[model samples]
Target chain A: MRVAFCFDLDGTLTEEEILPQIAKHVDLYEEIELLTKITMRGLITFSKSFKLRVRLLSTIPIPTVKQTVNTILVNRPLQEFVRNNKSDCFIVTGNLDVWVDEFISREYGCAYFSSRAKVEGDKLIDIEKILDKQEAIHTLRNSYDLIVAVGDGMNDCSMLEQADIGIAFGGVHEPVSTLINIADYVCYDGLALAVLLKSLKQKYGREN
Target chain B: MAGKIDTVIICAAGLGSRLGLDMPKCLVEIGGHPLIYYLLNVLYDVPNIRMVVGFKEDIVMDCVRKIRKDVVFVRNPAYTTTTNSYSLYLGSHDLQVPFLNIDGDMYISRDNYEKFVDKIVPGEDLIGVTLSYTEDAVNVLLDSENRAIGFSREKISNYEWTGIAYLANIKIRKEGLYIYQELEAYLPIQTEEISCFEIDTPQDLEYLSNKMGHL
Candidate 1:
């Protein structure tokens, strides 16, 4: 059976949340914190919140954001799993493609889907599109027999719900209750998540 | 043949209403620590631990996570109408390996449990039986060879099913029967005597609390 493993980028893969790291690096801490409060209070949708964060973060040059993202630590075991299964792995994130493109390619060397950016040479620019995570699963469904999704945030809810198997990972923090309620399996440790990914792959991938 | 059984499936989804604690029985505090703490303390060596949770699962998951970060939480949404066998079935998903299945409410002697795990042989299923003591016990009818031929509640037997076993796979051919009743189809399976206490009622909890010194 052909299987696809989709991962959320921010808190799930990176040890530190990418946007927060970028915000802290460029001294946008207060602005980002206010936005986070609003987002947590459920005043805005994920797409809207992401777009707002991206637009606010656009003041920093694209290269600086990419550099900050690359400098952040990642869950090594999970990263290695994606590296080994590059062909079957994917990064489904709401972050702008322009910022993470270079970093993800350099780190994981796997296919990725993210929000589109209309960049004009490193200056603050307008938002083009915000990615809906479920779209990634829909696209992967056309090629793979089974889709296993892993994530830790509220935005990953639809993507996980659409996948054949959903795993709520708490490598950085506890998975939200909504995601946890629907997850097929919930894991806390990075090594355990990696092991679970391998086990699931073996079980479903061999059936075909 | 099986190698080492690395997976442990703990069924903690039941409402545990019979215990009248208004909480999952596994979370019941015995001597300050929850019942599951005793079992997990002994199962420290296991790498892949799957816990089937429902009926106040958030509480169970939160408590278990503090002790073991590697546990795989499997949701049993139909827990209200299902039995522990169904929870076992859910927990076994995607696992093609042999595993040790234990009920969540069992308080097993740590030393005895370690030895029981040590005695497990590859490719052979081992049933755990304790001395008949619970008010509503499923007694195991064993042959001279110590192989379980049938399970009976009416028959007076020395051993009662402790709801623990090292299984190759769970084959639920028949539905609605309790786990042991379903195991009748695979009769004459091997049995082992272990020192454990199953808390099913207030009396059982009190007995365990008083018998803690002896255990």
Candidate 2:
């Protein structure tokens, strides 16, 4: 059976939230953290909060954002798992593609879907496009027999709801209640998440 | 088919209302740590571990992740209306291999529990028997060979069922009988006596806490 393993970028893969780490670069950590918390709490819509967060963070040059994201640590076991199973892994994140592109490419070398950023030679201008996570799952539906999606944010609700198996991961932070209500499994650690994914992959044809 | 055991199924789904703690019994604190903490430590060497959680499952998972993160958790949403036997059934349904079943609310000595685990031989069923101590227990009736012949609640016996067993997946029946009662059809199974304490009431907790303090 063909299976696709989809993961959220910020808190699910990275040990810390990426945007907030980038916010630290421009002394706007508090603002970005507040936005992230409300977004995760479902107090604000993901699109609205994400757009505003990007506007606030766009002040930092593109190079600075990439550098900050590069310094952020990822969950080691998860990274290694994705690196080993590159053919079956996909990263689905709402973060700007311009910011995380280089870091994700170098670290994981896996296919990714991210919100787009309109840039003019090293300077951010406007949000070109916002990624709807469900679209990534829908796109992979034809090729895979099962889509297992993992995330820890309020924005992940749609993608998780659409996937064959939704995992509410809380390794770095608590998964929002809305996501938890729909998750097939709620995992709280990185190694545990990787192990679950491996098991699912192994048991796909036999007893899934 | 004797071989090394690969998996352990820990039943931690009960409300444990008898203790009146308003929390999952496994989360009950004994020596500054939850009871499940000690059990996880005892099974540290086992390769694959699964926990069945229901009452306050979020809290239990959070607590366990801090200690051991690799345990595969299975949710038993019917915990309120069911017993540990049902929890064991849910945990073992997908398992095609032999596994160790253990109660969540116990404080077992590491050395003694390890010895019991060492005696495990896959494809062969074994029941764990501990010294009789609790006010209420399912006593194990042993033959001259020290093998378990039957289980009784009212009969006086020197050893009580420890709620720990090593058996293949075929022994698990879907009936909601208590774990020991479920094993009645498979009686005359091998028995392993280990040093352990099960917390069922306030008295049991206090007694074991003091006993562990002196140990």
Candidate 3:
């Protein structure tokens, strides 16, 4: 049986949120951070919050955003685990592909389903489509027998709930209570998370 | 089996009326720490742990959250009228992998506990037994193969039940039955010698307190 590992990009794969890092460059860090917190707590809807946060960040130069994305630290152990198991790993994020594509997709060369952004010749424009994480999981479920999802925010609730094994990661931020409630396992350290993923792979990976 | 023992269903929903404690038995302090603290510390290698809480669940959950934020809790609302079997049933009802079923009232030396964990082989069901005698101990009758054929409140055999077991994936038929009674249906249970004790009365608590300095 095939098994897939789904990861959330922002809080699960990176130490910082991509949008907040971009917000710092445009001097809207505090405001965007508040919005991010509210959205993560499920106080506000994810689609509305994503549009608002993207609108706040759209004015920044594309090069500046790319440079900041490069500077944002990836969770090294998780990156290594995904790299070793790239065939069955997928990044499911609500972040725009135009912003994170270079660092996350191109750097790792891993498959991802992310929000699409309409870019008009090097100028940041508008969101073309917001990726529904649950839908992505459903699509992967057709091929894989078991899906293990890891995330920390409220936007990840649906994907986590849909997965066979849901792990609420608190490596970047303390996972919201809603996500934790649905998670089968909760991990606080990146190394521990990596170990858990490896153990799960041994247990459910197709080769096993 | 799909995996090694990755989950532990700790039945902490019982009300320890004999111990004269206002809190649940799992929350009773041995030496400034809850009884679960030692068990969880030793079980760090196991990835999934579900705690079934009922009487004073909030308090027990609070203590557990402080020690290990990863623990998942399943509340048994009928803790007042139910036995540990019901709480065990609630915890392991939906699990698909092998798990260790333990009572929250149990306290053992770290060395012996690690030995018990080491003895657990994948896909094999095991029950922990000890030669130590207690009037309330659940006695077991084992065949020559060391498979338990009978369990009784009276001294029916030389070994006493230790309230710990490693179970394979099997659905438990919960009909107000004790965990042992349900387990008896699946006879030929493998037995292991492990040093463990349960804190059910004031005397057990006092005995644990005396051993606390060594633990």
Best by the lDDT measure: 2
Candidate 1 residue-wise lDDT, B1-215, digit = tens = 22365888999999988889989999998887888888898788787888999989889999999888788888888899989988887777677778889999988876777767776878778889888877578999889988888898875688899999888644643254488976787787888888888888899899998887565
lDDT tens readout by residue for model 2, A120-193: 99999999989999999999999999899999998899999999888888878889978877776777778767
Residue A32, candidate 2: Cα error in Å is 1.9
For candidate 1, give the lDDT: 0.84
lDDT agreement of model 3 with the native? 0.83
lDDT of 3 by residue, B25-127 (tens): 8887879988989888877767777788888866786688789866776667688998888888777755567788888888877677667777777787888
iRMSD computed for candidate 1: 1.1
Model 3 chain B weakest lDDT span, ten residues long:
B169-178
lDDT of 2 by residue, B1-215 (tens): 21365788899989888888898888888778888998998787777788888898878888998898778777777789989999998777645567889988977887887778777765788889988886678999899998999899876679999998998634677775798888988878899999888888888888878876886
Q: What share of the true interface contacts does each candidate keep?
A: 0.72, 0.17, 0.07
As for DockQ, the candidate ahead, 1 or 2, is: 1
Per-residue alpha-carbon lDDT of candidate 1 for residues A1-208, written as tens digits (9 for 90 to 100):
9999999987789887777778986688778767764553346788788777877787888888888878978899999999999999999998888888998998899999998989789875877888989999999988999999998878888999999899999888788778887898888888888978888888899996
Q: Give the lDDT of residue A92 in candidate 2.
A: 98
Q: Name the regions of candidate 1 deviating beyond 4 angstroms.
A: A37-43, B1-5, B169-177, B213-215
- Candidate 3 CAPRI classification by DockQ: incorrect
- Candidate 2, pairs of clashing residues: none
TM-score of each: 0.94, 0.81, 0.76
Which candidate achieves the best DockQ against the true structure? Answer: 1
lDDT of model 1, residue A20:
73
